[model samples]
Target: MAHKKPGGAQWWIVAAFIGPAMLAILIVNVYPILYNFYMSLTNRNGPRRFPEGMYEVVGFDNYIRLLTQSEFYAVFGKTVLYAVICVFFFFVVGLSLALVLNHPAIKGKYFWRTLLILPWAVPTWITAMIWRFLFHGQFGPINQILRSLGLPAPNWLSDSFWAFVAITIVNIWMTFPFFMLILLGGLQAIPTDIYEAAEMDGASFWQGLFAITLPLLRPVALPAIILSLITTFQMFNTVWLMTRGGPRTLPGQPGATELLLIWAYNQGFAGQGQRFALVSAFAIVVFFFLLGLTLLYNRVTNVTKGAYE
Candidate 1:
């Protein structure tokens, strides 16, 4: 039989099916990013100024200000710390849960799996609100339990360190389930024979985990880790809802828990003066930073995997 190439009609059909989605993406995603980049170069301060066309192109002033400002550096550092802590805990907890569930002797695996994923199933806003109440200063259950136990109850939201801890706890609770699901899938994909071989060779659990499981799991886990890192880096809703990024220790600085997205939001909308241009510059910087990190991560993971192979 002769091979026939797709004709113009087929190409048109393909484009017809893809055109709406492509157009939507361009308008909804691509256009806004480009517009924000353009706005970052201008001195537009507020919504009113945006429409007036009176905003002057300030060039690199906004970028320079963001890069030079102590406040920006503080927030950026805190955001990176938040991402690292959250992603680290997420991996540890998620992998532990997956390992437990993956054990051959475990019963009701489906039921346990379902229950474990409930946190991710809930809306993040609702989870944030619940955690907020739990972390309430006096009447909250956590404090009540602490007082009952004859222990001092620290004010969670009003104190800087506790507020940071509270936000981190809430974020970990809400996000660990996602990592659990991803890691569970990875665990199940591993061949039972590899593990059995390690066991037959008298490998201990920890030895097998390090020698057999981890190396095999890396390929599956790395992408999920990167995704979790990005998600945690841009986290805003849970932090905002829980503390409003508060327990501010410094007079003119962001709250201890104010990650990059929340800082940008405060700059753009929450503060006394709207700093649209500054916010845009911050967004541009964050976009490029994340882009570079992602590229570097992928490159490193590929190199490591190739070396292992």
Candidate 2:
């Protein structure tokens, strides 16, 4: 017997149920991306804005300029470096906390977990602002405490290196809890019997961690790491609030802490002259970069799985 597909009326019923959501997504998400792509091909610098038919098509000039510009490359490279560092620390700190919290001997696990997650729970903008104030060069509490101990307090935001470090510290504090929660869940999902069998076999902690726990956790942790990488790559508010991408290493270049998103914001809105089309090109490049990264990661993951199987 042959099976029939849904008839027009049945398909119409299904569409009736999902059409509104699809329309909403198209309007909210899909349209803006398409518009941005269109804008990237135009010369729509601010004060000479694009009207329906007035904007001049610049072809790939905007993209070519971004690619050839050393400053743009610097910002892109720094953004990648920032994401890598943040994700690495997120995994390390989160996994360590998860292991400690998962320890059978630890009491009041619930209380400690709640306390630890407070930073993640609080509004990120508020946390960023608070950290900014705390890192103030002379009058902040951190400097005050250092002075009480008779130690020199370096200006946190006034120096390029320290400003980068300061933002990284704040981002790590705000983000590590997410990794901790994910890793904790992965740890809990691991069977205690596996550990018991290893213990019975006289396997050392380091040996068991390397041979068993990490291998098993890999499947769970990989996705979380990718997510954290994406989040860190686009991080803007916290770093912007902390330094406004200041303490520049060069006169006209982006500050050490000005990652890709912040650089885009500066070019489009906050710079001496608004370059809307240039920013749009930058956004397109970023989109492709992330897309490539995600695809490459997934492909590698699949290849690894296949090999293991």
Candidate 3:
């Protein structure tokens, strides 16, 4: 059959097929980001403060103010630290589980793999809520165990340090299985001959792991690590449900467990006054930071180039 020209009826037919999806993407994804940026440039706090048309365009005032605030840097540093810790554990735990499961001597591989991945299979929100109960100061199972053992049952969700630890554990538990699955696939793709060669060459278990397994796993693990880092940095639901960014570490400051999103959330909704513009500015800053992170990761890793290459 002869090929049709790319115009007129053909273009309309193509548009007819894709127009709804494109429009939906614009409305659902693109519009919100653009609106948030717009909101960031204004002083729209709330109806009481701005009163619909009363809000004024403040140029870069919100960004300037946010940048100048010490709290912003504090929260940002805390967020980065949280992400780093979570990702580190995610990689370590996942890789360990994957390596064990990949071992030929391991028994019940399928069963153990399925059991280990249950956390990832469960809905994160449900897990967060369940963990919240588990971290309860009194009646929770964790504290109950501690009390029964005559150990100090520190308030997990109320103490500043423990609250941060609680949220970190929840996030790590909910996410590590993802890394396990990815790294496991990478592990399986490796040829047995490579390890056999290493063994013959007198490389020890730890040496083989560091020099061969880890290096080979990089292509698969690096992308997952970067993605998890970004996700953990912006994570809100798990942390919010577990601690709501409390308990306060200092007066008139962000809570100890307040990652970037949680702080922005409190600023916009949970605070005495809804600082919409400020939160929008916060969102914009976070968006750019994440974007820069992704770009930098891709630049260094060439992750987008190809997995095998």
Question: Evaluated with TM-score, which candidate comes out highest?
Answer: 3
Model 1 scores what on Cα lDDT? 0.86
The clash number for model 3 is 0
Q: Candidate 2 or 3, higher lDDT?
A: 3
Number of backbone collisions per candidate? 0, 0, 0
lDDT of 1 by residue, 1-309 (tens): 335665456777889989999999999989989989998999988666755567988798899988999999889889889889988999899999999999999999999999989988889899988888998888899999999999999999999888888888888898888888888888888889987888889999999888888888887678788877887898988888877778788777888787889888988988564889989988899999999879977885776564333
**TM-scores for all candidates?**
0.90, 0.90, 0.92
| Best-performing candidate as measured by lDDT | 3
Q: Which residue ranges in model 1 land beyond 4 Å of their true spot?
A: 1-10, 46-51, 296-309
lDDT of 3 by residue, 190-290 (tens): 89999999999999999999999998898888888988888888889878877778898677899989889888888888856598998899889988999
lDDT winner, 1 or 2: 2
lDDT of each: 0.86, 0.86, 0.88
lDDT of 2 by residue, 1-309 (tens): 235565456787889999999999999989988988988999887755744566788799889988899989888889889989989999999999999999999999999999999999989899988998999997889889999999988898998888888888898899889999988988988889999999999999999888987888887688788867887899999888887888886788788788989989988888565888889998898898889879867875765564223
List the candidates ranked by lDDT, beginning with the highest: 3, 2, 1
The stretch of ten residues in a row with the least summed lDDT in candidate 2 is: 300-309
Candidate 2 residue 113 C-alpha distance from true site, Å: 0.5
